[model samples]
Target: MPEIRPRSTIVVTLLCIAGLAVAGVALAYCVHLGAQRDDDTGQSAAEFTYIPPNQAGLAADDVTPESDEVPEQLDTVRSKIMLCTIDKIGTDVLSVHTPDGRKHQLTLSPDTHVESAKGNEVADLTTGDLVVVRVIESDTATTVDLIVDGRVSSSIPDN
Candidate 1:
């Protein structure tokens, strides 16, 4: 039989309370982060809008060009961002299949940056990860930028 000391009981109670407080703080922080990520995802998804090929010219006509704009500079590059599913991941490339039924092998360089919700690196990317890739093409060379994990937004209508 162990003697029940009031001082020992108080210490144990305080420790339990402290543990609960820490757990509560951690839970709150996690919730806050989740909300923040949701907000970011919403904003990013809104940036992409689908336009049918037939309406491409009509959509372009709606925008007026600025006459004051200077000619294209040497550093000017064309870039496209696409949402795709990873079919395979390699040391310096990623094989992805797009919703358009096209498979592509995107080259990765030392400068390529990969991101995910878990703060993962390029090596952490696995097969079948939905990702958004930015491909930039210039007269001299083509390069890729950020490859970030993504989700299909409900706002986007299914084909």
Candidate 2:
């Protein structure tokens, strides 16, 4: 019913362009956040186990000459064993098999991590690769430290 105005049409077009720009920026930011979350998920898997520091023979330090001597508690040593490989290495954890034919899962600690030799040789390992690993026993759970220097031999059986 009213006459068409060129100035009003121009203003409306500019506002529509500004709204589209804002929406595009928001979508890009959301995608970046999702990628960051995926990267952090592998790091959190390291918390599965921890070893406590040695604290034996502390009470004996407070004893005086006149007082009765207190017996010091002996520290218990943990055993290290070879873990059998059951599957391929992942971003954070490795699947293994125990000597008793039971399945066990292990994780790589931040301090004790794995590296590939010969340009991504470790990454090429597939399921049924034979790998020797060292593990430490802790109160909370068992922690894997190092991978014994070797490659997956063909003699090992597949899971």
Top-lDDT structure, candidate number? 1
Over 75-98, each residue of candidate 2 has an lDDT whose tens digit, in order, gives: 554648675865646666678876
Task: List ranges where model 1 is wrong by over 4 Å.
Answer: 1-73, 139-142, 151-159
List candidate 2 stretches off by more than 4 Å: 1-77, 113-125, 152-159
Cα TM-score of candidate 1: 0.46
Cand. 2 Cα-lDDT: 0.61
Using all chains and alpha carbons, the TM-scores for the candidates as numbered come to 0.46, 0.38
lDDT of 1 by residue, 48-116 (tens): 555444446564447534652344553457999988999988887778989998998777778888778
